[model samples]
Target: MRIGILLHALFYALVLWKGSQASPYWMGLLLGSGAGFYWYGYNLLSLRETDTKLRGEFGSWTGMLSSLATMAAPLLSGFLIASVREIGYPLVFSLSLAFFAWAFLISQRLVTNEESELPAPIFCRRHPNWNRVLLGNFFQGIREGVFVFFASIMVVMATGSEWALGKFTAVNALFSTVSFFAVGKLLRWYWYNESMLIGSFVSTGAIALFLFGQNYRTIMLYGIITAIFTPFFLVPFAARVFHVIDEAHERYEREYVVEREIVLNGGRVLSIIAFISTYRFLPREWIATYLLLVGSMQILAVLILRNVGFRLKKSF
Candidate 1:
């Protein structure tokens, strides 16, 4: 988890630095996507060795703790961008660099586990489950990139200020923080997929109001709705993926989970790149239009899940 945060902080710092040079957003996307693909491909070939280490060193809880970092990113970024608006982008990059350094040092201090002296057995790579995980990851990436790429544009168009977008992001972060706790409780009552499907529908409904709303209210409502449901949708899918990996590791004695996760993250990066590449070409007014279109797509995801026999059924 610490290593991942260090890497993320570095990545964002580079983006801020590069953006100062007037580099196109597409370039940042390309860099991120290229790095992800290279990492994913390497992990795929080294699944056995990677998993063996991860199982002995980190295990499933690494994923749960890592999730908190996701919530922290936008929150920290929002505050930094706001406070450092005077010093400008370079300062922001430097600040992010400091964060990376601190996180890296913390990761180095952690002790290594010694239980993993032997190689694990490899599982069936051909399982249909891998395809489902991959596709789900792709769509999840698409959803994330689309929301991030246009959200600021939409806020600025509606509110006419970058500062407004910062406030909106901060609000969403607060909501995300709250949702993290809320979801831990919600899981006791709902199945993981069911939580995701319901949250998607809830978020879709909130987004639909943007077609009529023009004030900060639109963004605030969107943030609140997304905050309420994102963890519900996101955390469970993550936990279940790790659950499957743990089960596989137990049965096969091979640690394929981390490698599989890396592949999934790579797929996610490609999906984001594709979305950003296409969306960047659209006219500015189309930003709001695409938000509406994405909301409809979320609705469609719900329907697709239902028809494909993925709807949650109560089971012990």
Candidate 2:
């Protein structure tokens, strides 16, 4: 995971610098999409190996920590872009790379000799439940892509400032961060699937409101609504995956918790491509409406998963 972040920091920097040289938005997105796809594949390979050696909760802890770093990347990037004007993009990326490298070094030092003492895992036959895991995670990718594609245009149209872009994005990030901890506690006390269902309903309603918004105030209001519900939608998905890992571990001593990090990022890469391919011809209002349309798809996913008896089953 540390290596992945290091690669991401370096990758984005190069893409941005080269994109600036060409200065075309679609071109930049194309480069980013390709890199994202490759990252998806790489994460799958790495996580597959880790799955065999680690217990479910232990695997989840590592994944959660890696995600913590991923969450902080944008804030760090924003500071870099804001502070370093002379060698801005590249320098920002370079700093990100340095941070990731330091993290990797720290992770290495923390590894215990016992980590390598575990025997190799005996493979289990593929499980049908894996498909559901993939589906749930894939929609999350679609959700993120759809949100970014449309909301960015709306912010630009409403405020007419790139700076507003940074501010609202920061706002969204902050909201998501707060929701992460809040939802963690919520899950501890409440039903996992129920919270997610409620979140899905709120998200759908909020996106619908986004279609009606025409100014910063409405957009921020919509953002707040998203803040309330978005974590519910996401956190349960991780919890569900952990449930699967736990179940697998119960039957197979050396359990392999298949990581969907690859598929999730791959879906995002595809969504970005789809966004770039179609966004130019679409009006801003239509983009907002399209986002609402995309969000609605989650309702179908929820129904399908429930019908198939994929109930929430978190151990803790």
Candidate 3:
């Protein structure tokens, strides 16, 4: 996992570096590789499933920590872009590369997974129930990928400065971190789907409001609200993935893990391509268009989750 993350950080930095060099194709290839390897690295190469490994709302802790760390990136990038101008992005990416390398070093010292008896595969077909969750996750990924790819650009378009983009993202990260922790605790005490539904509903309303926004302030506000509600779907959905896959069939745990990554990466690739293709054409309203797409997909996700057959456990 650490190596994968380190590689992703490096590749992602390379892609961003290409942005300045006018190498769009190279940037796309690097971006795709980074995303693909990130999945393999996190779930396959680094993961060790033990009794404690699969227990509790593990996604929440990671999500919050990730957001907390990530909040600094945009802020620092904004500062660097403002101060050093053209060299800022490279510096930012280089810093990211260093951070992940440190993480890799630390992870090397962690205990390895304990040996356990492997269960025989009983089911080869994907569960109808599991499919619904993956469907929702995929659509959500599309919305999220596009937003991440274009959000800073949107801020830059509106404000003409990287600092504004940085501030907006920093606040969004703050909200996400807090929301993840709060919603994580809430999910442990209440039904996971309930939090997921509430988050989806609120995020839908905020996205609707965002469509009418024209300035950086309103857009920043939308980002904050969206961040706050994001973990509602994210944390719960993650928990449900463990619930369905681990509880349903221990033997096929690894299969579902792969399937989840496929759905996520598929959506990411589709959305990024869509945005990159249309970025030039939809100059004035591109933000609105993608925001609408995100809102629309999120609504679709809500509908898809409704079709899920299993009742989520109420507590951790």
Q: Candidate 1 lDDT, tens digit per residue, 1-316?
A: 4434545665666677566464566555655554554444333333334432232123223333444565565556556666777765566577767876776686566554455466554434554554455455545554664675556666877877656776676667666766666666446423655777887878767776677765778777887787778666665555444444544335432345544555545544664665665568977556556666555554443433332222223552
TM-score for every candidate vs. truth?
0.66, 0.68, 0.81
Sort all candidates by lDDT, best to worst. Answer: 3, 2, 1
Using alpha carbons, what is the TM-score of model 1?
A: 0.66
Error of 3 at 304 (Å): 2.7
Query: 184-290, model 2: which lDDT tens digit per residue?
Result: 54354245567668888898888777566567888877877876677676555554554565544444323333345555666676777766656788775576667
TM-score of candidate 3 on Cα atoms, chains taken together: 0.81
lDDT values for all models: 0.56, 0.59, 0.70
Off by over 4 Å in 1: 1-19, 22-88, 113-124, 213-215, 249-289, 292-316
Q: Give the range of the ten consecutive residues with the poorest summed lDDT in model 3.
A: 45-54
Q: Give the runs in model 3 whose Cα sits over 4 Å from its true position.
A: 9-19, 44-56, 111-124, 273-290, 306-316
Model 2 scores a C-alpha lDDT of 0.59
Error of 1 at 92 (Å): 3.0
Instruction: Name the top lDDT candidate.
Output: 3
